[model samples]
Structure formats: C-alpha cells, structure tokens
Target: MNDLDIRCAAPSDIAAVLRFWREAAEGTSITDDHEGVARLISRDPEALLLAEQDGRITGTVIAGYDGWRCSAYRLAVHPDRRRQGIATALMDAAERRFLALGGRRIDAMVLESNERAHRTWGSAGYHREGHWRRWVKSVRP
Candidate 1:
C-alpha cells in the first residue's frame, strides 16, 4: 500500500469529495452538496481533511472547531480501501489539527447502527456516550 497523503480539503476538491462520499460513506447528509462544502471550505479552510493515494481519494474526515467545541463528521473510507490504515491516518491528522488549535476534547458523530465505525472509533480510544442523546432540527427546511 502506498503512503496516503493527508491534508485539508481545498475548494477544488469539493466535487471529488462529494463523489467519494457517495461511494464510500454509509449515509448522506443534508449539507453534502457542492455549495455547502464550498461554504465550509470558505469558512474554515482546514476543517475537511482528506486522504489520497495515487491520485485517488481514499478517505475523509471533517474535523470542525468553532473556537469552542471540536467535532468530527463524515469519517469515511473507500469500501475497497478499508482496513488499510487510511482512517487512522485521517484521524491522526484531525487530532493533530485539533491539538494545535488548543481544542481540549473531540467528539465524533457516528451512527448507532454503524458497527464498523463503532469499532474504528473504539480502537482510536473513543467511547460511546450512553448518557447523552443528540437532538436536531433543520433550520433550512
């Protein structure tokens, strides 16, 4: 396996990232569109982290810090590229970025049914918070 190149996503990478997520991610998000992603890159240039090898996107993770809380989203790895340490590399980069930004804690939003993701996150020392539940409301709709 070639060493994956891990870095922040640029505006030019938005389309490829959306395509990659459609193929690799478990589920879609409401804001997975080009405009949303572009807006994210525009707002926080280093929030979306990507892993590539041989010119193909292998994995991605959104490590967003709003100067207060650090949250991770869209942690996806290509189906064919799973178990090849790509996710780990992406997480490593994300953690480093968070630490550099003085983030004290990091939280990830993983689906309850995504056992693979649970295992991945567990291996990285993340535990599920049974005491807390997430509530959401779409402001756009």
Candidate 2:
C-alpha cells in the first residue's frame, strides 16, 4: 500500500478530483455535480480537497468556510480506499483549515438515508444537534 499524499486541491487537480468523485460515490450528488464544484471553487478555492497516493487520487471532501462557521460537507473516499483513515485525515485537514480561517463552529447536514455517513461523522467527533426535513423547489427551466 503506497502512502497517501493529502493536500489542498487546485484548479490543476480538477480532473483527478472529479474522477475520484465519480468512482468514489455514485449515488450521491458529489461526482455528477461538477458545475456546482466549478462555481464553488471560483467562489472559494478551499472548498474542495483531495488525497492522492503515488499520484493516484484516493479520497476527497468538499468543504465551505464563510466568515461564520465552517461547513464540512460531501466527504468521499475511493471505493478501494475506504476504511484506510483517508476520510478522517481529510476531515482533520479541513477542520484545521477552517479554524485557520477564523471559523467558529463546524456544521454539516447528512441525509437520513446515509447511515454510514452518520456513523462516520459521529466517530469523527461530530454530533447531531438537530434535524430538518428541508423543502426545495428548483426553478429550473
């Protein structure tokens, strides 16, 4: 097992980042949502992070940090790389980056069907303070 190289993703890393997103998580909106990603990165570069090993992408997470609280969201580890502490490592960096940016609290919203995510977040020191059945109506034409 080659040691993984964890770092902040740049515009040059988009292809690898998108590849990981596709192969890592299929059902979730992470991979297929590249346009959204472009917008986010354009808005804030630190939102998307990647972990690579031997130059091969292994893990990824999407985070957003405003002036207020840090938002850790859309975490994913390549299918072949799951359970290797990749996700945790990514989260560690993310939290640190957020703190460095003067963020106060960290928050995330996990889907109710995603039990594995719930457990992962909990194990990663996150707790459920509340829940919401959010309603959204997209005005797509």
Candidate 3:
C-alpha cells in the first residue's frame, strides 16, 4: 500500500466515481449521475474529495460547506480497501475542510440499515442524534 492522496474531485473523475459508488457505497442518491456531480463540482469545487492510492481511487467523501452549514455525504471506501484507514483519512480531510471554512459542526447522512457505516462514523467520534429526525421528500422536477 502506498501513501493515500486526498484531493478534490475533477470533472474527469466523474465516470470512475459513479462506478466506484455502485461497488463501495451502501445507497444511492438523486444526485449520483454525471450531471449532478458535475454541477456539484462546478458550484463548489472542493466539496467532493477523493482518496487515491497508487493512482487508483480507494475512497471518497463529500465535504460540503454551504457557508453556514457543513454536510458530509457519500463517505465510501472500496470493499477490498476497508479496515485499512482509508475511511479515517477521508473523514480527517473532510473535517479539516469544514474547520477551515469556519464550520462549527458537521452533519453526516448515514443510512439507518447500514450498521457498518454506523460503526465507522461512531468510531470517528460522531454520535447519532436521536432527538432530530430527518424528514425528506423526493422532489424531482
């Protein structure tokens, strides 16, 4: 294993990222497509971070800071690459990004059924807030 390189995603990496998600990520999102990801990179170039080792992408995390709030999404690591500190590195990068942007706190979206993710997040010092429930509506125009 080589030193992992964490950097913001570029447009050229979209296809590879989508495919990586299908294999590594637990769930899908409305903005999983190329256009949607492109829009994200265009709007906030530093939001999507990719972890690469020896030129292959091993992990990813979306560290989005909308000036007021810091939101973490799509924290994924290749199945073959799990338990190898890839996720920890990604989270460390995301947290650093948030702190640099003056973000006081971070909210991560993890699936209820994803026990693996829960453990991962918890080990990273994140606690699930039972008081707040997420209410979402799929609004596709």
Instruction: Identify the runs in model 3 with alpha carbons over 4 angstroms from their true place.
Output: none
Of candidates 3 and 2, the better by lDDT: 3
1 versus 2: better TM-score goes to: 1
Task: Give RMSD (Å) of candidate 1 vs. truth.
Answer: 1.1
lDDT of 1 by residue, 28-91 (tens): 7779899899999999999999999988999999999999989999999999999999998899
lDDT (0 to 1) per candidate: 0.93, 0.77, 0.94
Give the runs in model 2 whose Cα sits over 4 Å from its true position: 139-141
Runs of candidate 1 with Cα error greater than 4 angstroms are none
Candidate order by TM-score, highest to lowest? 1, 3, 2
Colliding residue pairs in candidate 3:
none
TM-scores for all candidates: the values are 0.96, 0.83, 0.96
> How does candidate 1 fare on TM-score?
0.96
Candidate 1, poorest ten consecutive residues by summed lDDT: 1-10
Q: What is candidate 2's lDDT per residue for 104-128, written digit by digit as tens?
A: 7888767778788888889999888
Worst 10 residues of 3 by lDDT: 132-141
* Sequence-dependent TM-score of model 2: 0.83
